[model samples]
Target chain A: MNLQVSRFQFFSIVLNFIIYSSILMAPGITVINAKQDGWLSMLLALGVGLAANFLYLMLFKKHGYPSLFELMDRSAGKWIGTALNIVIVFYALHLTAMVVRNLSNFMITDVSPYSSPYIYQILILLVVAYTSYHGVKNLFLISELFTPFISLFVIGSLIVIIKHFKIIELKPFFYNPPSAILEGAYSTLGFPFIEIMLAGAFLTYVKRKDKLVSIALSAIAIGGAVLVITVILVIGNDSAYIVARESYPTYSVMRDVSLTTTFKRVEIIIGIAWIIGLFFKISTCFCVAMMGIKHLSKSKTFRGYIVPCAILVWAMSNGLHKTFIDFTNFVSMDWTLYWFTLYSFVIITMLIGLARKRA
Target chain B: MQDWKTTMKANKTTREKIVLAIVWGFSLYYIIGYLAGIDPFPITVWLKAIYGPIYHTLFGG
Candidate 1:
């Protein structure tokens, strides 16, 4: 009801959304498409993501504190607003399911062949549903608590992997075709970055309306930069072919960790960080889905829908597609063009329309 | 004024009780079981019944 989250809490939420799934897989995917120039495409993707964030901020400024639902109502009228909300809600749920299935597949393939993928999905969904049911305040608190530990693990992993870095591995920077680099940028842009469109749903909760733009922009910049650096490190250290072949390249990089016989098998440490960050990402998406349902139902209490919604989400993940490749292909070609472009246009148009009306 | 105060107090207490029950139930059912090494069979079955077919169809077991 208060509709105002603290700056740090806001940062934690955005960071959580930006950190998972993509960070683990983007470098590998990028190298597959962009070869030795994968890091360059990643940087380009970050810039594109930042530009998209700016456009979102422009819209937020014009609307003051209106949530995405409210903004849609004001801009498009009731019938259109309701339809758009349905579209976005279904999209949000689909993306949430995609992330869950993707992470489950990664765990099965990269972490442990013993555990069933269903086990990982249910466990992750339970954690996400529990956190989301408590509402955003609890979600923020949990993220803040895990933030320090995740940060330390990421930093420690980078440090541990630094000794294995070979300068010669980065020698052939332009080996990949130019078209491939462009295609990789397009794909990466669709993922972890452009997907920031989902953040607009949560941004309305930030208390300091005046600082929202600065905070959101800074989060994107910092998150994207962290991702780009990780990509560079992954590409610089591993052969492009090896990097491209792995499902979870960064996790594989962690597997390569052998620091003077003391810090071997650091994949577990990376696994812990991945689990925590992935939980936050799934939880944030689940929260948005809950909010979308509340807006649709015009209900004040969102907690009632959590169980049914979680069940539906688990079922929907099964219905969507199979394999990580199908999921990746959807994100790259379909989701990037349709969901990303549509929301970007709608938000930008709403911002301009609101601004003109105010004038 | 007295009636308003009484109603407000009642609502506040009800909300607090609900929150407590939820927190306690979630911790006991989810976190505690996870910590105590309980196999998450029921939840996995529910998920598998939903997702297994998709993977099976797409990847072809």
Candidate 2:
């Protein structure tokens, strides 16, 4: 069966893919690193992310490959291409596991500290795996349907919290040493920004390719602007120290809003929005992993592998880190660098393919 | 050179089954071990070891 997504749906998918996970912890990570100037760091990361994406798209277009896997196959030869595909499949699965763990950790610490994270893990995996099994349309459709509400949640928080903004909180602009600001940008870069390369998996399935590069970049720009605004709001509401210390600063921002005597529980909406965001995130990664399997095995459908995929993702997520500290530590400090390994793989393959002039 | 796609097409079921068995085996080991509270083989130990030098170098812990 052929599957295709419209440009608008693809835009929504890319937007949610970037926003959901990043918004929750990125503010705290950036604030902790760049302090009050964290927004600058975030802006810097977004700028770099966009430019990298532009270059990636242009190179792949020039290479004339429908997919990165195809590019690798023609460039590196058969055995090596299969190996690269397997490595990427593992990477996507690892991402699914890590994202699930992120959700479960959030639930335990913030939503219900008394609840077992394993419960959330199982519950979420059931939905995610099932959505992934139905194939890409179902997954992307879910994201397209819910994109507006998530956007509104962000916008509504901004509107309601404007009264609380302390313009002074954004002071001492650029006070952070360039290295510190760059460090903040570097951490955020590897995450939601650079990870956009995952879009390569779905590129061939997109109905519109001519403007796809611009559409994707625009979607990312919007996502980045949201992150920057979130930092401003988060820092404006509380001191940088406090915002930095909060595990989920954007959640904290929504949780702390008090417009009236009893109308301040915007956090419920934020929580629901984040859950949907995570659903898209995990489901997208799961589907990509499945797609990689499809490409690698040359299989007709990836349906039969869904059960194992869910089981492995569950186990890997549980076994990924010993504690929440390890999880957050790796994510905050080293995730970008770890994820860069995939980029390094792609660059090597692309160079070899170009040198061979297969096109 | 055996074309990988052609090779995969010829043995798709076998290839998929091998992939499934491998995933199940690896994950089930962790699942059973973690549930039994034994964790005979912890992947984190290896992962952290690999990422340790990189993390320290990048963030300077």
Candidate 3:
């Protein structure tokens, strides 16, 4: 289709990716590790994430707007490039599966237990596949249309939960052990930040290379700051013990809001926000993955692969089973380390190789 | 390797069209399943089987 997306659309997609996945559960997980100083840990993680973002920017600048696949082929050999492509494709597929499973679990447990996770996963994947199959343009347009509502929902959640924010709850914010802070930072950096590496694939399509670095940096900064504030507010509003034990602490904070006793249980609003943002996130990732597959296979019609890929993703997710705790532990422990190290190495190595070639 | 421009110009045949239609039909199974509340059994079982092994390998219970 020779579809080209605008910079604003790209920016909105990036914003959606950054905000959706981490906000809902980060408060709960970070507090479990960092206690009263969870927000500080998030800030530290933000600093690390920003540095990584700059590193990715440097790689992009050196390559002069090459897509991730092209850059890998240029800097590394064709075989190595193909190997890396396989790895990235699998990594992205796994991520999409994780997200689907997580969202399905949340919806099934909280919203409607009668609803089957299988149904939710398949339906959502179809929507994602359809949007992605139409190409990046459709995905970007959807993000643009949904961005405002997602933003308002997030901001509104913050406002509604603000009444419970107490200075006393934030006291002794630096009380956590250094190990706890380190663990929290490591997990966060591994997750939402390092996952930004996947964005490199889409950089080739960005029309404005001049502003790409700045916009990318801004996404990390703004997204990280929002997460930090959310963590702080969650910690301030809820007890550390409660926050740690809760599955969706921010949603719990939303539930606690009741302005006139009539506006009770407003957590559904937060669910709507997460769903919108998460939908865009998954759709964008699916778009990039499909694009990469097309580029690799030299396919004319990318839509041909959508059903197979979606089926693969649905299977990958459904295999994870009924235990959220097991999934949580895997994400927090194993996946975090693997992704953070792998992405950091890829970006750094690509930058060095590209720079040397340029020099 | 053929150039991307030329590659994209290649037209889809009737078989490809038929295949695409069938794929779309399978994809829509989910929509109908959700709305009708019918269980699509063997596919769901297959998914669970694939996911279970991978999750176990990744997390190691």
Candidate 4:
């Protein structure tokens, strides 16, 4: 069955994908490294992300919107492409596992300190596997339908927190040394930003190819703005020290917001937004990995793989880190570098394909 | 050289079998590790050991 997503849906998918896990953890990570300058680090990351997106766009244009698997096939030949797809599939699965683990870890540690991570893990996996089994159209549809609510929740949090914002807390901006700021920018650039390469998985499904670049840029810009706002508010309201110390600064800031004299603890809105966004994120990664697997194996049935995929993710995520600190240290010290290196090879191969085409 | 598209379309290729085997093997290791309460991320440990210094050198914690 052929699947197609309208440009609007494509835009929403990009927005949702980038915002997925970043809102909860990225601000804390950045604050620890860059302090008050974390927002500026995000700004730097945005510029780098846009350029990288432009490169992917050009590569897509040259290759005529092949899915990442098919693009590798065309550019690198059958055997090599299949091999590359194996690696890409592994990377995608690992990412999905991390997203799952991160969400479960956050819920267990921050929101419900009494609950077991396994419960959230099973709950999230079921939902992710369910959505992924339906195919790509449903994934985009869900994102299109849910992104507005996520946006509204984030906007509401910002509005409610505005009165609590202290300009003094945002002071000493750019106070971090150059290395610290660059390090923050480097990690941010590596993540939610460069991970936009995952968009290639759905590139073929986008109906209006002419508008692809614009849709991508707008999505990246909007997603970057969301991250910037998240960092600024976290720092502006709670200060960099609190943001650095806390595991989920964005959630903290949102939870701290009071709607009025009577209404407090408005974090449910943010929680809903996060859960919906994470659903889309994990589902997208799951779907894309399965798609790549299907393409590589030339299998006709994708549904058959969904449960196995979920089981694999569950095991890998469970085994990959024994504790939240292990998870954080791995993502901090290894994941960024590993993903950047992996995708950099992909971009290089694509660029080589482009060069060969020109030659 | 086998024509990949033809091989994949006609039947499960050898490469597919190899990939499946490898994936299943890795999955089994993880599953058994979980059951045995063993660490499943030696790769993570190894990479962190190797990359941690390089990362700190390049970016400085």
**lDDT at A156 for candidate 3?**
89
Estimated TM-score per prediction?
A: 0.82, 0.92, 0.85, 0.93
Q: DockQ: which candidate is best? A: 2
In angstroms, the error of model 4 at A85 is 0.7
Model 4 error, position A276 (Å): 0.8
Worst 10 residues of 3 chain A by lDDT: A314-323
**Where does model 2 exceed 4 Å of error?**
B1-12, B38-43
- For lDDT, the strongest prediction is 2
How much is A202 displaced in model 1, in angstroms? 2.0
- Which lDDT tens digits does candidate 1 get at residues A43-144? 888888888778777777767757877777777778877777766776677678778888888888988887888888899999888887777788888887
What ranking of all candidate models by lDDT puts the best one first? 2, 4, 3, 1
Q: What is the C-alpha RMSD of each candidate to the true structure, in Å?
A: 8.1, 4.5, 6.5, 4.3
- Tens-place lDDT per residue, model 1, B8-52, is 556544444554354346434543444455532233344345555
Q: Which CAPRI quality tier does the interface of model 1 achieve?
A: incorrect
Candidate 2 C-alpha error for residue A112, in Å: 1.8
Docking class of 4: acceptable
> How does residue A352 of candidate 2 score in lDDT?
82
Q: Candidate 4, clashing residue pairs? A: none
